[model samples]
Target chain A: MANKHYAMVIDLNTCVGCNACMAACAMENQTPVWKNSWRTYVHDLEIDPGTDHQVRRRFFPRLCNHCDNPPCMSVCPTGATHKLDNGIVLVDDELCMGCRACSMACPYDARFDVSYNDVEQGKEFYGELHHRTRPGVDKCSFCAHRVMKGLKPACVETCVGSARLFGDLNDPDDKVAKLVKTGVAKPLMAHLGTRPNVYYISEIERAR
Target chain B: MEGMFYSTQNVWTWWIAIYLFLGGLGAAAVVVSCLTNMYIKTHKELVLWGNISAFVMLSVGSLFLFVHLLDHLAVIHVLNPFGLLTKPDAWIMWGTQFIVWMMVFSMIYTLPYMLETPFWRDMPLVGTILGWFGWLGKLSLSFHKVVGWLAIINGVGTVLYTGLLLQSFPAVALWHNPGVPLLFIISAFSTAMAFLLLVLHLAIKREEDHDIKVLYERTDVILISIELLIIFVFFHFTTYGLESARHTADILWNDMGWIVGFIGFGLIVPFLIEFRGVTKGWNSATPVVLAAILVLCGGYLLRHYFMYAGSYERPYPAINSIHSQSNYNLLIE
Candidate 1:
């Protein structure tokens, strides 16, 4: 368990822009749905708009990268945002002072503040059994709770076309490891030096 | 496509800006007053008011910081000694430590002076409380220079912490500049001088301390000059440097508050007024007071605009380029 390293591989070729992951994440994490925020979401990118060339739309899914060198963790005053042994970054609600310094430091726009009002509304919107009990900065935890139970993240579990893949990167036999080893799957903004665990397989390679 | 993916950071707002301004102002005031007392002349009134103002400003700024927190009670976690020990690189943790120590040291430094003042010594309940701390005041007076030096060091720390807090956020292109701390330090001192000038002219009405007043005006002129130059460097660096920084410059350039309020009214006018006063003989209090007010306003505006102009780099530009070019090639193929 100490050697375990979790990672995700997202294939743009297989994703259908169905947004099943967003819904699954909202239902699972009880995010501020009324505010249109999510732990994971898909962006419909239009390439070469208003040009002579044919315009094309691609679905780009995004989430917290859970970087090895998380800037959010370094900037957090309360030591609330921390990395687990398995490489998943998580926030301790009781420790977070809600300063949003993590949100300011994150390059991927991964974090959002959960205010007192959001928590009060959440009790009604998500019922009393909601996992979020206190207000703090919130982000995708790679569904660490479920992952600890030997289950995939909600978004990966409910992906419409099986485009999302999650596995331990430390295991050479895992599909995520192979995809990363082959260089077919690449992390976004690699030059930023965050060393993100989430990798993306480009749609252009799929078309080729 | 250039501006399509750019996002302005919205987490921090005016509250954080106010906290930064007040914290810097307070710390700078303490530094100036302490140095003046040690080197030039020992003015008890100056020391007393300076320490009191610093304590009050820092307290009010901390109040704003508390208001900005989403979970107010969770702020206690920031005081965990373990977190402070472990997170040495965290500017916020260092800032909290600096601020707390500064408040404590400033209060102790002010105690001896407070006990000496008849207004405080004769007060009913407060006088009794002051009497309780009279022994502590004697102890502080015995080691007055040590307490003053400690307060000065922490004051400098608090001032630098204000800028370091923003500089630690590498994601915000506007705040990530090396010039940020320099600019903030210079502005903090200049505004501190202006604050003292206002107090000297209006509150203390110390016309006899002409030498000290001249010293403040001279120091402020130099500080303001350096600050204006650093601002130029800031604009040049941000404009020609990173893409996100260039975008930040564009936003800041168009901001009237940054251009007119901060540059025109805040820095330049005050500089000219002080420059003329320093060069010529004694002038009216009206212009001096007006210039001080402008400088203070300008200091707050600088922080406000810097906070609002924080822009994140566009998401994965290299990836987007590859995606578009590769897609176009595939369509052609």
Candidate 2:
């Protein structure tokens, strides 16, 4: 809702998910390579038996959709989870109670529990020092820190396919808006009440 | 068949469901026990003991609910208790509110008794009223959205959360189903009965009353019947549908012999002894203890299998399942 609302439109028709985007994101954000990164790829979906299992795998790279009406925010007993007008659901690092309630309410399984964790000394995690900072939640921030300085998402910038497109949807003339007007696109889980902002192109066999 | 939508519940869902069941069970049990205090001495002791369980249920229950609900919304927000009748989402919001109040009333009514204060014990009617009020409040949360509207608020929450709680992982297929709500409610009922029997035996023994021992023993037969039916449906129904679900059934049949020991030997044995006690017109704790332990084991194992078995990836039969899909673009955060 600021200068422009950002949204992602995935072109499933042209995507050759080479894991380049994931690595770029981790490097740019200094995120650890552990399971709880800001982004993840839920690939290897084998829907049917064919020539072999290798060919059946379908990649589904994911990050938070930064939905318009997120359920995760409403169920927080404390004011720890906050959704900005710009469509970002933020977990205030300081106020989280380490309660796993929001994780359950999330239909998308977006909330990750950083709990029961112990810090190990001298462990170089993703080129950064690994240390437990207490238990809480973590997920993609849509690169807010980078967005403040005026730049595209690190993944979009480094993408080889130009398959991932991001732009202001509020503007009719914007790139994302133009793509939306013309291309066949889909969202991951459309049935759940949460109105996800991310869009996809081409027919996707999503888990209804 | 096309893939349908579903969820994989994890630890968070479990926390919420357990909280709801404990509160609902504790509240409902107290209401029954407290209300019948005048007619039966066993009921009086039950009313007194229900206080501790009520506290345990309410305290731990609300903790998990709040943890999930708070983060789902941002900042400071409170449910418009009035909108519960209008909006579907309002159901959960309101159900949670009702549970909290019931917790409050029960705690307030029982504190003096817990502390052995003459004030609360002297006014038994007030205590009874509190228990009734708590029961109504807790019961409201259990209403399904059909009559209640939108989604299953408290009851379905208590039930399906158990399923989703187990289903979130791929290991347990039995717990993962659209049929989860029904299964959970049945299991919860059976488990509650198992606990009730144990508690009732104690309450009755304390009163030195043998008249109702036969009734308690009869109830065990009913509980056993219900539990077996539940288990049968859970295994047989799922086994016939999906192949992956069948594997889960196999896991239960093959490796869950300990489950029989727990449910049959432990629970059934006590139930039988209690039955014998009734026929002889005597009181016995041995049967009650055995049944309680067995029922508890059954409940825990039921959930455990679902969690572990749900994680197994099943091979789906399909033509050209190995078709190399073209790499597609995805939304970057």
Best by lDDT: 1
* lDDT (10s digit) by residue, model 1, range B171-288: 7678876789999999999999999998888888877888888889899899999999999998898788787777678778877889999999999999999998899945578888
i-RMSD values for every candidate model: 5.9, 10.3
RMSD per prediction, one decimal?
5.2, 9.8
Name the candidate that leads on TM-score. Answer: 1
- True lDDT of residue B2, candidate 1: 51
- List model 2 lDDT by residue over B1-333, tens digit each: 143222233343345446645654555444434443434443435555664575576678766656553233321233444434432332244455555455555454444344343444346785565445565444433541122222113333433344444333322345445555455555555555556666766553545444443454565556566656766676676668565466555555666453566456634565575556556634546755666667655654554444433322211111111111120010000
**Candidate number of the best DockQ:** 1
Model 1 reproduces what portion of true contacts?
0.58
Where's the lowest-lDDT run of ten residues in candidate 1 chain B? B316-325
lDDT of 2 at A135: 47
RMSD score of candidate 2 (Å): 9.8
Off by over 4 Å in 1: B1-4, B123-125, B316-333
Per-residue lDDT of A172 in model 1: 92
